[model samples]
Target: MNTDTARAAILAQIRARQGRPAAQHAMEVADVEVDIGRHVRGPQPALGDRADRIARFTAQAQALQTRVARVASAQDVPAAVAAYLHEQALPLNGVAWDTLAAHPWAEAGLTLEYRPPRDEDKLGLTGCFCAVAETGSLVLASSPATPSSTHLLPETHIAIVPASRIVPALEDAYALLRAELGELPRALSTVSGPSRTGDIEQTIVLGAHGPYRVHVVIVDAD
Candidate 1:
């Protein structure tokens, strides 16, 4: 059986053993919604003022070795990305999410394939679902247009983050997801920085499993 169907079957069996309804009834569903709506959050760190979250995010991200660039608007993204690739001495050809196909990549002298990354692809560009300022993480929700491989399978991953989508904490990101998406996607990846591991002799090694570099371009105007 498929994963979803198997999961549902297991949960139904557990509910049956617990003497509860095998499936959620309308009243139970409404009650659960009410409980969620009235839930009180636990203590959390003070994230400072709303205006400072972006700065905090930038600082935290930089500490994790994530290169960040700020742009005034979405139209400026192409040039910013191109400059980053040039600075890193990387190629101008890469893969990007289909959602970003309308961007002026050609004008910036960058050639991008609007599809998932291949095993040999060196760079990948994508737009984030949202960003968590508390931990400086990018939330990537997988879909047909925004495949997870774009970020995971490339040597360098560039993400376009809109400033308005930056939240103060992880919990806030989850709340935003529930409110906006209603249902979770098949996969949700929270990437903090470039992949690293300290497995050999406790020496840290970047790109141990995934992208060697993560460059974020934040647009001030969403």
Candidate 2:
């Protein structure tokens, strides 16, 4: 076939598919939240099962948020964090500068200090400004509680997120802040999970540059 004809045929095929209904985008893994008083068993077997599928999947996502855990207030963050570190079996060797919010993170191993970045410390355990339950995103702002480098320099990042901070939807995260926090500052980042990509060969790989293991200890304050 001539070059022009071949190009025309390709364009026609593309246009035909463009008119068709496209598949929905992949759902973000975060943003699962549930009030204390709520109950739903297995899916009810019914004819309109596609809706059932969405419900079932959503329930499972909701369960994950519940399982993630929670803590009372920011002050309790440190204690809960100590438990997490003990469970994870991480040595308290490194000491990277982190934002110390009100949450009580149990820091049994880590010696809390204000230190400059050096070759010794690899772990930059920190807390975020707010948690987005919709995407399981950790929102960090430029403040004394959180430093920008902690997110990047850490080999293993452990973020302590409380349930109260978990908003119902992605947009709700911003709404809560807009009312409570006036005139937000620069550099607001939403981190979903550990840094990962499958660009090379469609094989998923974690820890490209960010933390290899991102264990979000979701604390239930209630």
Candidate 3:
């Protein structure tokens, strides 16, 4: 039955329950009722009310930016990025990478085979679609331009972030997307923290279904 019709019928029955005859009839277990007048429901809150919360978060996140460790800068990203890979015990090459601009790893003192998306990659590094400053989220999207495997299959992943792309919160990122694209696009992901699980007797473990660690390299003067 339509929800509005059912609601109207239930309200009418409640209003007349005391005055009308009480009749007992067999009923199915699936049918149930809700008292709507006592309940509150709606779409959600608007953006203006959420403004202060996101702004405060931006301040907190900018504070953390001062404490980023092991940061080494380069003119171009590949060389510095390669150094990060070597530090993490990853191979110099033979790791598949896909990004906004996938370049050759030769200049970084690394040599890796660039395989198709369907093949496996020991490590994957992709340029982030967006990075939310407040929650430290990295957004990714899957498309013909960005294959899904470049995100999911890799054991260790790196997010090559541009300083300009950092927003305060998930909402800010969404707003930017809406402004740039003129509507919400498909396959938006807000990845905060890392992939971890409290399985096997509640012991905390990393690297279950996704990458064990997400190394974010923020390129300066982006």
Estimate candidate 1's alpha-carbon lDDT, on a 0 to 1 scale.
0.93
User: After superposition, which runs of candidate 3 have C-alpha atoms over 4 Å from their true positions?
Assistant: 1-74, 94-104, 112-119
TM-score of 1: 0.84
lDDT per residue (tens digit) for residues 59-126 in model 3: 44344331122233434667766776777777665444444345546767765544444445566666
For each candidate, give its TM-score against the true structure: 0.84, 0.58, 0.62
Residue range 78-115, candidate 1, lDDT tens digits: 99999999999999999999999989999999999998
Report lDDT (Cα) of residue 108, candidate 2: 44
Model 3, residue pairs in steric clash: 93-111, 93-112, 94-112
CA deviation > 4 Å runs, candidate 1: 1-40, 48-50
For this target, which candidate reaches the highest TM-score against the unseen true structure? 1
For model 2, how does the per-residue alpha-carbon lDDT over 57-85 read when each residue is reduced to its tens digit? Answer: 23433443322434545556566566666
Model 2: per-residue Cα lDDT at residue 26: 38
**By TM-score: ranked, best first:** 1, 3, 2
Error of 1 at 135 (Å): 0.6
What is each predicted model's overall lDDT from 0 to 1?
A: 0.93, 0.56, 0.58
Tell me how many clashing residue pairs each candidate has: 0, 33, 3
lDDT, candidate 3, residue 40? 36
Quick one: best lDDT, which candidate?
1
Lowest summed lDDT over 10 consecutive residues: which window, candidate 3? 63-72
